[model samples]
Target: MIKTTFSIKDLENLSGIKAHTIRIWEKRYSLFTPERTDSNIRRYDTNALQRILNVSYLNNNGNKISAIAAMDDCQLEAEVKKHAEKGNTTNHSLQEIKLAMVNFDKNLFNRVFNTGLKELGFQGVFREILIPFLIELGHLWHSNTINVAHEHFISHLIKQKLLSHMEHVDYQPDEQHKELYILFLPQNEMHDLGLLFLNYELLSRGRETLYLGTYMTLEALEHFQNKGKKLVYITYITVDPTIKKVPKFLKQFEKNVNKNGNSDLWILGQMVAKMKDLKLNPTHKTFDSIEQLINGLETSKKLEH
Candidate 1:
């Protein structure tokens, strides 16, 4: 069996239950005590993580810890599903998916994705489950708790599913008439999954989008220029060209995009968001979230109709 071992800290991170609280639950309520390492450190298994996650979810949702402590395994599971059915299963799904990533278990990953889709639908899964999972994955990767391979395993799986969802959605000919949105990632940035999903979001909302994908330079994007069609350009600045290089990147980007006054520039992602000294091109707008940008487009679409 693939190792599903986790430390108390991992349990704390995954369940949102502090280590001290978990200890109290163990001592006072006998919440499935974990096995001790040779060093006497608590080592939690897959089932323990699942139980604590379930307990954490129920407790957060108004179920008392004492009541949860009194319940049998079946009763606890019933309680978890009872509240989980009311929605907000992303937290529970996160742990399962995390295990799937660590083990590189494709079947388990598919099951988790399918379950999320059934519970929350496509957009809900993306916003509620997938985004939070990515955040956690990033932390694990950063802390060396998980490797880049593990990160890519989960990421590629999500990418495939997102593309599948996009492909399956029916788009009318009139939807094709919507304004062209060109999406890309700036040079040296390979994280294009977010951009790809945003294409789905735009396309689903009746907007025509051309996804140029990763490692695109401003020079390369100029080809989409002067097509006599006013284009809404979108790109992400994610760990590419470095922070100090952003000013220069924007300057070069301005040289190309600024040539066309009618072309609109939209910049997204964390690198761009956190750059305090970065200068935006004269022809650019920044969005805090994809939801904000999509809502803006929806509002504009309504006004035009």
Candidate 2:
């Protein structure tokens, strides 16, 4: 029931197939019949776009386009299934997810994620599929292989899914337990998928959380601290607070939240790992991955009692 119309550029961008070649395929092989707009401009629907992506994947992997076009849909699907079922590494799946992201194909992304999740489980999918996919996306964006719009589209989709999962968690607060973690990004940091998913994980464990979403100023934490409740201020420093600004940010954050003796700062992301002179305060800690951070929390709690 979903209408999936796409401009010619979207097809080209998503499939990595040249527009001219796509036209040739349309004319020569009768691959897809795209609808024409009022001005006679061609637009593709979701099904057509997905076919092109599948064809593109096949072509990229040494299948001849002419041969691919000659095959029936069932045959083509069989071939694609064989390739997909071959236990391709995480990198290959990441590439497919990136393509789906660019095209804004929720179906494709869901299909890919579900497939990977079935094979890898939630934690495995996070580490093997989602994490590497994000890293690759960042590299592509930084190198100008992908535009900012594509990055934003994909990130928003992922964030939405994480938020949906978070909503299903039943939160319970323990006054005696200093376990409620508030997660956010700094004012200039726009990345929230990492932080959002962390919230899902924490909430899944029956811990309480106050997610401030994204682009939050440090001053905002003061309001929460004023509540006189023990809370952990968790943040992902992917951008905005770069390595040079980390010491200053941490110093200021600690000074402000110091009034709440039970408060601590938990930071993660590439920027945190890259920091060399991270002024270590007793109330601050840096983690390389979400798993490490969560494990550390569990270990800390065990040692507390």
Candidate 3:
């Protein structure tokens, strides 16, 4: 279900403004006039949420709270647009993306995305902007600030961007590349935007990749092993294989997919935190962040040369 009302805490999580500061702004500048329930708890609607996000953006970018509060709705929005266009700062783009996700505004998302693409190019946009946005989106999801629909909506848009950009990549893997990168999501794990980005990264680097998308099982991966090339199996774990089952999953994965040690498993996402104490097999590697994964690959390539 779409969220119609949000609490002050939700605003705090979304806007990166403290609830106390929001309360102060409400009383001092009338920045928001939230409704009060019988229990006196503040409730804000979508319009108010949008305002606070814009206000927060301006405030973070050097506009004073008093100056922001004095502006009318049109003036406030114009200021936001002006500041956003000034540099298309990552924070501004991120705030705009968040607003787009919250309001289900496809046009807004596309505008911000296209602007980033023009200015930063695909790699810069993905690594410098979209990755941070996704990370914050994950936190918002966990904090109960956003619902599943918001995630799916934004993910679909980003997946579209990745696919369209992938189609434009002119690079092709050479016969001497000697490694095949296979990306997938574990069974019951449906989040694939990260995997899609990884595929784009591989393709952009002239690496051969087989993208299996989502809901992949260990048995399905076993088929690609021993193909006379070094197989790099990569997976993004968003919510599958409960923390309790991760050890078993890893064991089964090693036994079924990498039993011959001719392949490697590169694991990423939140699940990696759960495997800290678990003894990984020789062929297993975990990346705490996408930057680390990309950098590690480049570093390894340098070492290999």
Candidate 4:
């Protein structure tokens, strides 16, 4: 009932299967016969998408397409489930997660996440499974292959997990060699999972952090001015400031920083990556990935010592 019909392009985006390869599979192996629209355009149903996702998962895990094509649906489902429970490795769980998203099965999503959490702990679940899973989900969202419901379903699940982790983090700010980090998003920016997770990471490291999550204006951030020994303003900008508005935000942020407070703005997310040359004199730095940003923080912690 959730409009499960998809085009070949949607299948490609959702499954990471090249259209050409799908065509090849159809011709050579009779993969799944797609129904034709009134105009004879190929349209795939929910079952077809699931099959493609299952096939793609197996194919990515070293199963040959020809071999997969020969297997019956029950056999494929059993094998996929076997891999899903095997270990933290393999694309099986991600494939499962995708299917869960399609079905809007909250229980399935929790099961996959719990398995990773049990095996890897919180950070491990984040780095090993959730982050990579997000990268795939991003591709789906970017390609418009997924709807708002799918995106919101997975994001809120992740958000709940992050919040749960934060509740247990002991907020111990090291007295010596300590910096107060004010984490925020620019005005109109509503994405906060990345920023919240960062706050979690910093808090876990015993760093003092003030998380002003989402939709923070430059004017409001000025209040955190000069809050500690060393001040660092960190933010993940996913939306709100466009490629054009980014430079303007940089200028405004610099002015908004505690005057000569010797603060540095550490920026992350796509806007910075896209606008790599956007500079902030000596007041700002851009990180390409979360790992890079974490490494930078670790190095900063060492230097502060």
C-alpha-based local distance difference test score of model 1:
0.78
Span of 10 residues, lowest total lDDT, candidate 3: 169-178
Computed on alpha carbons, the lDDT of every model, listed in order, comes to 0.78, 0.76, 0.87, 0.82
**Rank by TM-score, descending?**
4, 3, 1, 2
Residue-wise C-alpha lDDT for candidate 2, range 1-305, written one tens digit per residue: 22357777667755668889999999999998899999999988767766787788778777898999987778877877777777754645665686676566778788877787689866577777887678767766775555777787778777766666566656665444656689888888877777877887787666788889788887767878665566788888887777877888887887765565678888888887687465588878888888898887688778977
Badly placed stretches (over 4 Å) of model 2 are 1-80, 83-89, 121-123, 170-176, 226-228, 301-305
* TM-score on alpha carbons, each prediction: 0.87, 0.69, 0.91, 0.92
Q: Write the per-residue lDDT of candidate 1 for residues 1-305, one digit (tens) a residue.
A: 35478888777766668889989899998997789989999898877866787788788888899999898778888987777677757766776787688778899889888988787789988988887787677677666666678778889999999888888877654542445789988777887777887898877766777888887778878887767776888987767767777778777876876565677788888776677555655567888777888888778767878
Q: What would the per-residue lDDT of candidate 3 be over residues 218-290, giving only the tens digit for each residue? A: 9988988758789999998768887888888888988889878788889998888987888877788999987
Question: Candidate 4: what lDDT?
Answer: 0.82
Decoy 2 TM-score against native: 0.69
Model 1: CA > 4 A from native: 173-178, 275-279
Which is the better candidate, 2 or 3, if ranked by lDDT? 3
Superposed Cα RMSD, model 1: 2.7
User: lDDT (0-100) at residue 176 of candidate 4?
Assistant: 66
Q: Where does model 4 exceed 4 Å of error? A: 84-90, 302-305
